[model samples]
Target: MKKYNRIKLWEGLHSSYWFVPLLITGAAIALAFFMLTLDSTGKSGLMEKSGLKIYTGGADSALTLLSTIASSMITVAGTVFSVTLVALTLASQQFGPRVLRNFMQDIRFKFVLGTFIATFIYCLLVLRSVHTDAEQPFVPKISITVAILLAIASILVLIYFIHHASTSIHAWHIIREISDELESNIDYVFSENPGNSHPEHKRQLVEEITTGFEQQAYPILATGSGYIRAIDYDRLMNIAKSKDLLLHLKHRPGKFIVRGSKLVRVFPFERGNGKLTKEINYAFILGRERTAFQDVEFSIKQLVEIAIRAISPAVNDPFTAIRCIDQLSVALCHLTQREFPSPYWYDDNDQLRLIADQVTFAALVDDAFHQIRQYGRQEVAVTIRLLETIATIAEYTRNKNNYVALLRHANMIRRGSENLFEKLDREDVEAQYQVVLQRLAKI
Candidate 1:
């Protein structure tokens, strides 16, 4: 079904149509029982002269007649209740927030009221049937007060059950919805924002990037040489087309290529001047290309927002987090050249950028850590702390300047973490930290 129709179905179930019928049925059942008591005693009591006369279809038998009517009504109500209960359970499982809430709320409330009326009426019916064996006759010294009290208690329990069921089903609906959305968006979610809470969001990292490596390249030296002729991209395209390279590879717009390297291979059809223009700053482009990190370009704003969410209570601290990730992204923004994979190529600046990025990422984790304490999730806290340690290790290894700047955030977040991650192995983080500290000592 369409989402809106499902929502409509939710509305219908919660609508006055179903509710009115349920309430009417409960009242009818309760009334039938009330009528049954009156008929069982009133007509029978009037007919009784001295003692009780026991006969099935004899005497002015109003009791006998209402019970027969009540029996059929109760049977029908029971079947209807059972079927509606099943339908309610199924609909609650298959839908979203608004729909599920409607289903759970209406059905639960109706059932509660129905059950109380049904059970209480049946109890009254049973009470009306009691009699003494040897001496006394069927005597119901029916206290109006006690009967009313019993009815009230039964109704109260029904209300409580309805409330509790509604609450539980609402929680269930959210968990399922979150889990489904997580499955679809999880990869993009993790790739873009590594600082996000994985398991709490109902997913874990698929490929964990453990010990990172940096591939360095030295800038070429030239004593201001004469410029070369602009190479025609049309001719290059023809050559590339013949080799079927355009089909095989995906290339970025600007590439700083070696003299012997093929610039492009393509299926040819191109214009003249715009296709091949000699870029004077090719050497600088090459220098920038060798140190690039990111390949794709998109907004980092969302990730920044996520960082803020993770560390919300302690600080609205979005700027610090955004700056750190922005630092990392700046290094990435330069990787527009299509060559090696991201995270491999970088200069010393990129290394420090990586450190700054990791530090900011870890600091945002402070919010998650603080929440772990605030919310009392020891298991999630442990997972987040493990990721924290891993990130700290990664950041600490980057460079001295970034290390000195970021590790100072330790004082800010050190309060809650003292006893929390105590059982987790610190060697991974400590070893990496020492490696950075040692590198910093040399500088």
Candidate 2:
């Protein structure tokens, strides 16, 4: 449960727009105090005597400089905010709303906003310390000098932000970024399991574990409603181990559950009491929306959304759709070579502890291409690209099931395109389909 909480906290911080900037703001405040302390302790005089260049202004000049920088920074900060909104709006209108999360999670964007706002606050703090009314008028020369440096740094950040914001909204850039995320998700989802079940043994093991348990199993109901963002498998295994129980997970991450729905099924019906039910529920983390943390399909859906939008009648951008297909194919190719984790989890004594839903190549392939195929039916280029991608993925796997999934999608693409395409278009798509057939046959 502690692990699950940590995952939630880290995900929250990653998705937050304010957390990073707030930290930067705090650092700026600390820097202001440190520089003021240096001036108050006569460190600025010592630096000047040592031939180090510093602010040489009296109290009035220091106040004016700080105030001008402060006001200008505030104005520029407003402009930065507006620019960020414009970029987000353009992304939402052009791409899907899911892409906005990527923009929000961007460290570069946060740093840019933080730098400008921090500079504004720094100048204001430094300006407040400048005094001209006393006989011994005081000026925090070091702090003002640091403020000047910060203002210069903020200007450079502004220039880079403009460039980054402009390029980030391009279709290929967004697609590639999502593609990279998909690859990372694939790696994380598949690489964590302790062992991979062989094809010959997986079915036998599942049958042995599940035989006759359905009639006697007690269902654990969900207490809340939301997507299953994550589940602590270690916690579930520990609970099952300690209680001498058999647990079957009813759903996996990326699945949605409503209140009172069957969440897990426990064997030996009488063992599932209120205390045990609460412990089981604690292992599953529900959220208002799905995340890519343990859900590989979440990222796959992001790519599919882009491809669907690109090939929509309103957009008619086949090249962008092709780009998405290429990226998905790269991820599928990587997936084909990896062994999938077995759903049957056992304890150290080799006793079955939990049965969970396994992520398979077939499901992933469908998740990546299903909606795009449905939406891109009328587009011959997209159909051909999908077949080409499937063919490319087929080259990486010798598994019969993987070949079957790839071949099935290829045939589906051909069938979907037959009536929609003209003569030449139909020929092109059919040719690609045949290439996929030949590729798989060779494998």
Candidate 3:
């Protein structure tokens, strides 16, 4: 059996829409051929005895029917692809291009395409067996019946796909989907050990690593240019343990690194023995795009993109912006309740061997609302909602530093609203600002 890193395998599968469906389509074709072969052998007495009169036609009739269905399937498949491309184009134009990944990762669309192709392949495979030969006229009754059923299934799926495509492009649906994904990613990354809030330990470790690196560490420059997609931490820890060296990573997942950038600094530089540099580089996977595997900020940025698009002058949709702010607040509230993992990694012997970068609450809050706040400055409702979101998050969090960050954002929103709104609109914004301050006072 082949083994794969579960996270990497899942990331690969999630990044593409074709692999699994292609496998399924191939398997369907093989299965159709196998069933037809079994029927030809006259070994399956139960299949022969079954009184289903679905395919009561002769070989010629079956051939004509299957061929027509296969052609129709191909036409429908073409139509589906056309509809998908149109939807993708619209989504890219309306929302940012980052959302193209969402549509591409959509399982429903992939399954619909796969179903049409698989059914067409199945029919084609079974159609080949329908022949009027010299000794026997062969017609795989069960296979033809299955093909007919699949054709009907394809029709139903087409209807569902049309409805789904239309509904999925709506702003609310897109925002909600992004929000759900962000929430799930937050839970996945932060839902362990909520009580461990010792930032001092992490700071101390970072200081020690910095000082150690300055004294004896050697820097490893990046060999290529791309975003850091994932880091194999377990393998890195093992290498660090084996080499008895400390490794300090210069970039985190989702960060872009250019060629010759400092990728990592190894302490006791001579301990790595030159070969460890290649192994260290192997641990860090670079790609053309960022992924949500270890990058929670990428998920946050999706919502921000939608919010920014909503507030743009062409869209001028403040309600959608408010909805995004609400979702961002919910995500930040959940984030505050959870403990972020320490950036420092240790070996089995409790030796600190790796120093990785981490995403902070302040950074997430800024990424979540900064762009929306900037784009929505002219809209009073959006500004008020921004303050309300900050107030809501402040109420949910116990950390003084988080409260400070929320207050800082609240101040920025208040400052931005001063010139953007009329007298009454400014009053409304001021009321929300005071409410946020009151919430902070209680905190």
Backbone clashes, each candidate: 3, 0, 0
Per-model lDDT: 0.36, 0.87, 0.82
Q: How far is each candidate from the true structure, as Cα RMSD in Å?
A: 22.0, 1.5, 2.8
Over 1-443, each residue of candidate 2 has an lDDT whose tens digit, in order, gives 88778988988898888988899999999999999899899998899899988899788888889889988888987888898899999999888998998888888888898888899889888888888987778888789889989989998999998999899999988988888888888888778863335456456766876888888899999999999988999889989999999999989999999999999999889998999999999999999878888888888889889889988989889899888889888988998898888888878776778888877899999998899999988887788888889889988999999988988888888889879637988888888888999999988
* Residue pairs in collision within model 1: 240-265, 246-265, 311-367
Any runs in candidate 1 off by more than 4 Å, and if so which?
Answer: 1-11, 14-21, 24-30, 33-106, 109-152, 155-443
Best by lDDT: 2
Candidate 1 deviates by what RMSD?
Answer: 22.0
Pick the TM-score winner.
2
How would you encode candidate 1's per-residue C-alpha lDDT over 1-443 as one tens digit per residue?
Answer: 13323433444455543565566456646655664576555654554554554233322243444344345445645654565565557544432223333344454556654654454465455445545444544533232223344455554754576455455444344333332332333233235432222232222221221112111211122222222212222333333333332211112322344443333222222321222322212311222211111211112222333333434555444333333233333332222111222222112222111111121333333422333334322233332343344344433344443344434433333332444565453444344444544444553
Show the lowest summed lDDT stretch of 10 residues, model 2: 193-202
Task: Compute the lDDT for candidate 1.
Answer: 0.36
